[model samples]
Target: MNGYRFDKLKLLVADDNQHMRKLISTIMKAFGTTSVYEAESGEAAWQSLKKIGIDIVIVDWQMAGMTGLDFVRKIRNAPDSPNPFLPVIMLTGYTHIDHVRLARDAGANEFLAKPVTVKALMAKITSVIENPRPFVRTKTYFGPCRRRRNDMSYKGPERRAAPDAIDVDGIRPVGSGKTGSHGP
Candidate 1:
């Protein structure tokens, strides 16, 4: 709260549960976010996103129709998506690592486990604003860069030459007249 302010942000809370929506809305309001909107289903949330100008989105994973995962996929992969780069904070009770990975793969900018707290929620928001992740776009993926930090300790197969090209380490160049792998 020192250098960051939420007063001017327009945030959306999308959840099927009424109490959860209210609680999140209350928390955002407390954080000085005046323009907070709520949607009961992912469909409604998608509509809101297409209609209004949303700064950030906090979406629940589970919903009646068009689950949060689907919504995120649409935002990231859909041709007519309103905003592909819009910041999204995935809200879910599933704290499992697999769930986290799933959310990340789906293009969420951040993740917030359920039973949300002021500190944790604010931390997510601030991180998104203060330190935005570079967007990644490839043939199979489009979203925030999954890597959080650089690791020089170990080596792994490099997948792409640039963010837009898939240059795998063990793949033959097309039309090179070579029909074999490059490396192990």
Candidate 2:
């Protein structure tokens, strides 16, 4: 029987380990990635990317040719390209926060430790795919608004103006015997 979705997604899984590459591709296929691509090295991954419209990239931190850090830097530095908005996830065996921070600073949208579980991996992929953040800001405004995970601020629909209450105008006795208009 078929499982979760496996369509309309072009994912690239880059790793030096053939086994790991297949594992990630299979997992992504199971999770409804229709067009999953695999690369055995950073250079191969970069070459594949040049030829395909990859929606997400799962890269290993350590690679033989251009390291994952270098690959990410390349993507981030290519700000003028049409596909510069690609969401990248760095996969590594390292657990240090500094390592994770460095990956983020180097243009990684998310970081995952090696031997990643299907649940965690799927969650990470889904998060990045569904909520890719903006790399540059065109404009910013501050008001009563909430920011989405993608960093887009949304101001809710405009509120309707309150209806004016009915007014009664009539001559009324004020103070002694003087008459005056009561309402307007």
Candidate 3:
């Protein structure tokens, strides 16, 4: 494990459950985080974000007013957002493949299932601190690059190589207007 100065980092924990918030705060404190903020809902989280200079955010998926996914989307796409480049770690009990994909698509930097352990939490924190992903800006998405790593060994056809690559306007690229001889 790398030696990180967690005490110097300002983290925000957003969850509706009081117990969950305390638990996460306790765990983060144990990890040496001195400045940890807690929010009871997404709206509160947003307010805190606007007021505090937080380094990282750990939010629950289901909140009272706004869900974690919605919060992430707003953070990534909202023009008035304080820090669009802020790193967010989503915590939820929904561990299904679809749920994971949904969180990723919603612009979460990392995902952690509920009933989290210290080890898992620390690993995610370290990963975010050490190997942060590059941000990608598109018409519909503005967050960390969705692709985690390149799989060179795969033999599947390249998705972006086709003329249907999504451009800034949601249509195909300009030069890709001509259809292939195969079909329209």
Candidate 4:
């Protein structure tokens, strides 16, 4: 709240649950957000996104018309999207590691599990405003950089290269192709 000017920001809240929408909106207003939009489903949210000047999006994971994960994918990869770089905060009841990874892979800038608290919501908002992640474009993905920060303490060989090191042809360096045999 120190540097963030919530009064000037425009936010869109997308959720199928009416009560959830109202609750989030109320919290947003309490946090000094003056302009907030609501959508009942992902389709409706997409429509609003096309028409409004939204600074941030808080979308639930499950919806009627389209899932939140799909919505985020569309926003990040769709050629007709109004703002591909728009910051998105994903809200989901599923707090499992798989769900979090899915949200991240879908290009969500932040992830917030359900049973939302004012403190967590405000923290996420502040993070998006104060420390925005850089957008990255690759053959398989086109959204915010997946890596949060560089680990300077690790003296071993670089596990991942910097985003700037990516080639102009949208090629990302290949990592170890091993995948864990367990879990979702």
Structural similarity to truth (TM-score) of each candidate: 0.81, 0.69, 0.81, 0.81
lDDT of 1 at 136: 66
Candidate 4 Cα deviation (angstroms), residue 45: 0.5
lDDT of each: 0.78, 0.65, 0.78, 0.78
Off by over 4 Å in 1: 150-184
lDDT of 4 by residue, 1-184 (tens): 2756779989999999999999999999987889999999999999999999999999999887799999999998888999999999999898755566577778888888879999889878878887777666656677775656533354453234443332211223344232211111
lDDT of 2 by residue, 2-73 (tens): 343558778899999888888888788777777989998888888888899888889999899899998887
Q: Please give, for residues 141-174, the per-residue lDDT of candidate 1 as tens digits.
A: 8988665542334265534332212121112235
The runs of at least 3 residues in candidate 2 whose Cα sits more than 4 Å from the true structure, single-residue gaps closed, are 1-5, 79-82, 136-184
**Which stretches of candidate 4 lie above 4 Å from their native place?**
1-3, 150-184
In angstroms, the error of model 2 at 166 is: 55
TM-score of model number 2: 0.69
In model 3, where do residues sit more than 4 Å from their true spots?
A: 150-184
Clash pairs, model 3 backbone: none
Residue 59 in candidate 2, Cα distance off native in Å:
0.5
